[model samples]
Target: MGKKDLLSTEPYKGVRDFYPEDQAFLNYLIATFRGALERWGYVEYNASILEPSEIYKAKGSENEEVVREQTYTFVDRGEREVTLRPEMTPTVARMVAGRRRELGFPLRWYSIPNCFRYERPQRGRLREFWQLNVDIFGSSSLAADAEIIAVSHAIMMALGAKQSDFIIKLGSRMYLDTLMQNLNFDEVQGKKLLILLDRSSKMPAGDFERELGEMGVSLEMLSPKTPPQDVLDVMERLKMMGIENAVFDLGVVRGFDYYTGVVFEIFDTDPKNSRSIFGGGRYDNLLALFDDEKVPAVGAAAGDETLRNFLETRNLMPTYLPPTKVYVALTSESLVKEANKVAETLRQGGVAVSVDFGEKKLSDQIKTATKHKIPYLLVVGENELSSGTFVVRDLVSGEEKSLSRDGLLSFFLNL
Candidate 1:
């Protein structure tokens, strides 16, 4: 092939290729997510990225625009339509229903899954990203909704975020439905008003009012009223549990049609990056698509890209340290074998170690180690080989210590 015809080095637009530092941050986010979820007794779950397209088409799955425009759908060789999952709720519901007879009640599950969506890429929105999905199944109580929100709060706090850094805005589909009933609006009018309410925050005031008027609803009829008692009760309960940042927001109509009860979105309070970090809500009837009976489920999903942006805005991103705790440099080409031996010994002692090849000069090797941010650098030379001792240099502190093999092992073990 001609050089000009070679493939481009850039990744597909709207996706990312994580280099070491990027991957380190991603790993840190994933580890923090997994740790927080597991501490709450939530088990991990996963499934194939490809699913039958009908799963999303089922009643109350997602909005029509998502299935029609955003989803990556194609017909496979089997003459059946397949879709790269745009979200996890539908797939998880299918799995739970398929094994409902064998599984126990109140299943607490979580998954960090990659989701695909074909949308205009913006600051917080991406076509491809990883999301941490946390769900609890077979719980109908309002406490389950509070617990899911609690888990969301816990994840933010675990990342060294304070309550002031973000706010949780709670809403309810049932509450909205009741409001519509009181106003004597039919289902068609109610649905239109919801779409308007969901987009109200982004619309100009005059434009929003005109749209509502076009739907035959007056501004006076749909003014910002006090939150209903149920929402207030939930807010009080959350505050009692130390999650003091939650409040009622009538505008939080989640895009999914499956959400039947309380809904919420966690928003970053920073004006520069002001947006919903992640959100999920009660979809008590989602599993009904697969089973005769419905399962009461409440869950939420947080995107890693958006979470990283939130951390950056707050200056809370974790430091990226090299995975190798120690780097061994050889004084001469002859000591290559000895350096490898020492590295192997440290590995056996449960320390992460790497040995430099003899092709590079000792100074160059130390520079490479420092570039990687390795914590310690050990030099293997004739004196150390004969004296059964080595000088370990602390890269961060710039201190040198003479240590035997046992002492070196003890140092890292203590760390």
Candidate 2:
């Protein structure tokens, strides 16, 4: 049947439905991310999917853009404008600032949660997704930035991605601002120019050139889109300051207006499909907008939808294809109960085993077991039941043997 004819269906387009195989991979990927976070000495926390609009507005932010631009928003029963959260950092900052007095200085935390963003769907980008957000709060030193970068690099590495498959592109707002100063960039004009630059690779060269023309640039074209100066001068300073090769790109000025210090993004090395795999930066002023103090913060989040595509592109997704390990078939009506008992024993031994209680014939049962990729099919027939044992048939090897309870357990234990 066609999907539209159904009474209800999935409404979201840039979302997914993960079944057994995909779920297995998802679980594996999440576990890997969690393990890496734990090893890096980070604690886990969560924020509600809904947040008050005021939290965003306090820092010269727009709930309407989130409501009208990026998020799934609606008027609640009380008619207050509430939004299903499109990101976690803003909420995290609110929670930290609210309890700032009680929490210790420099809180290290991580969260793996569902996030939403309404954008044009494509490979590596989606509206509904899961992301891992790691943060360091109350620290202003460069070490905090380094630790965040290291943790992000570690997560990518854990996912079977090599240094060549991914690159950590670090751009400091401090550094970028310094370069702008050298070029006499208007702070107002630069912001517009930066917005144009963000779309440089996304849109066509001709369109970007035209937009630059509108921005009062006398030069029709720019080398790498930053005219009147060599690109390497700014990059060379970063290299001189000991920034790793993992850090590149002077053109990355992230879209979020809150970033105040060192900022970084992870990008796939594939030039053709190169998109930011993840991005984050320090926002020391976000909390100060609400309170008296400048509460410093730095964090990063990687959407798994994007990360998954990055994995698939590089053939680095976790291998977690699922199948049964064992099946116990009741070959005769008299042996059915014993077959259940045998299956339970195998399960207790940490073997994934299923028993046949269906009315299918013995031949059909065998076919079903094989169809599910069950490795071993145990046939507990009347003859075997009388002998206090069962026939263990290795589905792959096609070898049969008479094995007692102890022998079967020992055999499975070895496997």
Candidate 3:
């Protein structure tokens, strides 16, 4: 070897390379999410993955680690610093503010955007992931909060998940703020307490208590037996709407300081995958960062990674079916044109068809179709072309049917 090759087959350390099977599952999850959101009159929206670096630096809006370390930021050719978005909320807020007067109030928008973060990858946490961000803008009512939660519940149910599959843990930044004030803690102390409480679930029991003690706060103050009235009202409203899984859990501070009111997180109930599937809360002031008038908003983001984990743990993942419903295999090179014609007829009848040239043996072609999991296979030979009829075999079952041109069109149309 004159020169050694230095190329690596691995994807970037923290990101993913979604092969066909992985992409099929991702598409299924996205379709399920889109259907649920659209049923609620939520229109889809998207933004460029690149944004100015300052967007993440907005006060009280993002996690510090996201800005200082996790973000993929670099100076472009023009010497302007750009960053791949670690989240979608700031960009969505910017869009709303840019056309605040033009857009209708109480707008429902949803997007499935890939976000990047430079962090240690674990079971559910990845460096790169796609998240479904659903939000209702320009609504301050607790009903808006409840509707957001309801949409999240709807997505779970749409994916064949039962009510018992997950639990909605409700919290309130406003309630925590009130408690801090009542306890005579200042803003700095309150911020520290919120960060601690947010990490409490992941921290060990003794270490968590010790940190709170060092900060002059006690565990009882954070996890009161009775939840605050607003949190209770939101949970009750969700319950009234037949979402029985909603409950109050005071430990959900939602990491971001911008969450002003009711916050909620959905957790997988299975012990094996016991982690947060996704969560969001009321960020009434996020829009104010752009304009003087604040548009009260509540939204939730569900990640494909965590949701897939939940479905896999519960055995609810959908079976992958190849997009091609029928594969047309040529019996020999002489019949390639005839096979193409047959595939065209099937396509005109609204059937997904793939034509295989006769490079491989006919038996090998059928094996390829079977290996791809295509449900139906049609072999076009000289006799079938001369007779204007073909045999279609169901790959799943060993069932075969002979049909004329019109009959073949009707068969798939009926299916």
lDDT of 2 by residue, 97-179 (tens): 88899999889998888877788888777888888899999998766776777788788888998877877766666655665
Kindly report which residue pairs in candidate 1 clash with one another: none
lDDT of 3 at 91: 94
lDDT of 1 at 81: 90
What global local distance difference test value does model 3 have? 0.89
Residue-level lDDT tens digits of model 1 in 48-121 = 99999888887543355577789888999989998899999999999999999999989999999999999888
C-alpha-based local distance difference test score of model 2: 0.75
Q: Which 10-residue window of candidate 3 scores lowest in summed lDDT?
A: 58-67
Ten-residue stretch with the least lDDT total in model 2: 226-235
Q: TM-score for candidate 2, please give it.
A: 0.84
lDDT of each: 0.88, 0.75, 0.89
State TM-scores per candidate.
0.93, 0.84, 0.94
Q: What is the per-residue lDDT of model 3 for residues 1-415, given as tens digits with 9 covering 90 to 100?
A: 3345667789988888998789999999999998889999999999999999887787543454567888899999999889999999999999999999999999999999999988899998898999999999998899999999999999999988999989999998898888888878987888788878888778999999999889777888776788888898898898888999888887798877788999999998887776688799999988887999888899999888999999998899888899999989887887888788778988887899998988999999999999999999988888888898889999999899999977898898787
